[model samples]
Target: MGTSFQDKSALVIGRPSGIARAVVEAALAEGAEVVAAGRDAQKLRDGYGDAVRAETVDVTDDASIQALAARLGPVDHVVTTASARARGLLGDLDRESLLQSFNTKVIGPAMLAKHLSITESFTLFSGVAAFKPAVGYLGVAITNGAADFLTRSLSLEMAPVRVNAISPGVIDTGIWDALGEPGKAEYFEHFRTHNPARRIGTVEDIAQAVVFAMTNRFLTGVTLRVDGGEPLT
Candidate 1:
């Protein structure tokens, strides 16, 4: 793909961190007018400076999403990295958490499609956990699986607008920072040994994949896996 977004405009919905922040930076580098939208306008502005138009948007709230869409008008691309983490065993999972997960991953994107007049494409975020199900992350897996199907359905329903999803593995997006340094090292080692790529993923890796999905016209109704061969093993 050509590395130029000269006249393009993009709206990235999620906090200014991890893959979302990298996507904004990548879009800016490619000359696109970008809006880094999230629940916190100040956080977005603080993270991106004047390079992007930071707007407040809570994907879970229909009114908030609609207002942002109205203010921005039409956009060339809409990338939603918004997701809620609901972790627990099947028995331990509560109804509220499960619904919240769906609201964030599945319903939120559906709402975005309903409100936003996306001209080029819409990209949603999923995860490898959906494919390689784990013991305690049943909620995450179910919601991510729904997200994949949502992308496929929207791609057909939305027609020429195009829609796709990206499923990433364990990337060093600071999400693992909560697991102290020692804990992180142990998990990273485990990931390295288990994954076919024998290494962890980076935010840049996933960001590049998002850029590919955004620019490629022929790709739709697909979930591009940006994982380091994690699912393969």
Candidate 2:
């Protein structure tokens, strides 16, 4: 008896991401059958190897999501890694961008909960932005808040189907690399100075929190903060 979820099945939305990739690996190592969904199935295959079942899913599209959900046979746990690149101030953000971000971060996970079996638990992603809104972070804050609230509400409504969120602070995901070296350094420095932990988070840190929530039957409707006490700053 290795673990109860040894042969359990999981669906991880947005498999190529830093957190998502770590989760897939963790789940598989724990004897889980993981379905890695994303826009690029090949990337998932390349990264996770041939053992993973890859699905090219566009979360923003209703039909695409519906079709995938229809085929996800008896999903025990669902974790969504889908997130949009944050953008805009309150005044500068447009409807389409806002909706795109919302649809991915909020609607996508909601739909997954709606369509999937989710017999055990469902985990969604949120961020510290939801709690500590910042300048030019209007969309991110809105979407993040929406996601956390959605999980809490869904947890109540979908009882017995544990639903929760993980709100991680600045993690060392390479997406930050897209911000360029100087930007990355500045961002990390801010987290280092401001966070109680004195360093940014890592993908594995967030993943461990996810595992705890999902495996603990007594927990639900909670937003576990895995930012190493980042908000305490």
Candidate 3:
């Protein structure tokens, strides 16, 4: 609840780029000691260096999540921007893809709540597709929708240890790189023109919202939509 994270310790589980990396930096700037973990230990170590305690864990694996929890002891804040999405149209979807999506974004965080020593707050990552649906995003939709409810359910179970989710819009997180340069540009341009905010979101925009979710004690059980008001227009 306090502005100062001077004495706080945070565990951020995700890759060493974009939203996760931004959150780690933001916490450090606010004077919190951070442990950055992801599936690739080498990448994490290489990216964070001495500035943070870089580690490794596969959120989709229960043992991996538990092992990291035991090793880290207690932490004041827990965050996961980790995501595994299955993007395809209805007929193209497969069971394994759907399961991967759920495990990484929804079930993985659920297991994290069960295993991790969260002393303060647990921040999960959701997505705007849960609100504004479209073709080729059914897998993304169901997984993110579940995560939204998971935030509320965990808030009740975690109680005083605040539980919330950050539902981000189209941030420049390199997730769109799969679309190729021109395609990515076209996608962002569409949002720029149609969305109420009239601009693509930056990682900093998401980081600011995550800080609010962590600092505001009254914000539990909520899914903070940092989506440039896309669902509205």
Candidate 4:
């Protein structure tokens, strides 16, 4: 977090809100030149203002990812926080939804790792749902599980260049806004008492974990469980 990021270039691809946006802000604060890319160009610009170079890339599309890689010649660090959630029980799960989830969280990043000229480290996103499955988390579980696997295998394949994954707990990213205030509050309240952390996670928690993964050259081929002991309880 100190001079590690200073004078370095980073490519952060994800949505402009929640964990992605927070990572961008954190990298900028660390004096890294950050290029923020996501599916939404306007939101990326709006979220980061003049602080970042906003661009567009859809993780589900290989061509889009390839094009983005071509545009970004080289970078010291690359972090992909993009993910898609298909919320349905196994019985109701559709093939396309499951495929899309894997494509975004796994395959897309796999392509990114293959094409991007990453000099320092590459960080991907995973979630506690992979280990702690819920009623409608079939898609989340498998996709996140695959992402963690990718982190390990890629670290070996891309040796000398660190590869890590960040597995976050239920964080207060605006993702819960879809459930409305009452539902979100009730959901958080339940986790507040259920998890050993006794509180929900924040975007900063995951962002700082990413910074650690990027700066610590020796830490590689592992998934950093920044879930605040959510899987323990």
Q: Per-residue lDDT of 1-233 in model 2, one digit per residue for the tens? A: 23747868888887576999888877877778889999888998888788789987888887887788788867888889898856777788888898889999999888877776778999999999888888999899989999999999999989988999999988898888988999999989988988889878999998888888778999999999887676666
Clashing pairs in 1: none
Full-model lDDT, candidate 3: 0.92
Best by TM-score: 1
Over 1-233, each residue of candidate 1 has an lDDT whose tens digit, in order, gives 34567899999998888999999989988889999899899998988898899999988999998999899999999999998889988899899999999999999999999999999999999899999999998999989999999999999999898899999999997889899999999999999899999999999999899998998999999999988888888
Candidate with the larger TM-score of 2 and 3: 3
Residue-by-residue lDDT tens digits, candidate 3, 1-233: 23458889999998999999999999999989899999998899899999899888998999998899889988999999888889999999999999999989999999999999999899998999999999999999999999999999999999999999999998997788989999999999999999999999999999999999999978899999999999998
The better-scoring model by lDDT among 1 and 4 is 1
Q: Estimate the Cα RMSD of every predicted model relative to the unseen true structure.
A: 1.3, 1.6, 1.7, 1.2
Across residues 32-118, which tens digit of lDDT does each residue of candidate 4 receive? 999999888899888889999988899877788788888888889999988878888889999998898999999988999888889
| C-alpha lDDT of all candidate models, in order | 0.92, 0.86, 0.92, 0.90
Give candidate 3 misplaced runs (Cα > 4 Å): 1-3
Q: Name the TM-score of candidate 2.
A: 0.94
- Clash tally, candidates in order: 0, 0, 0, 0
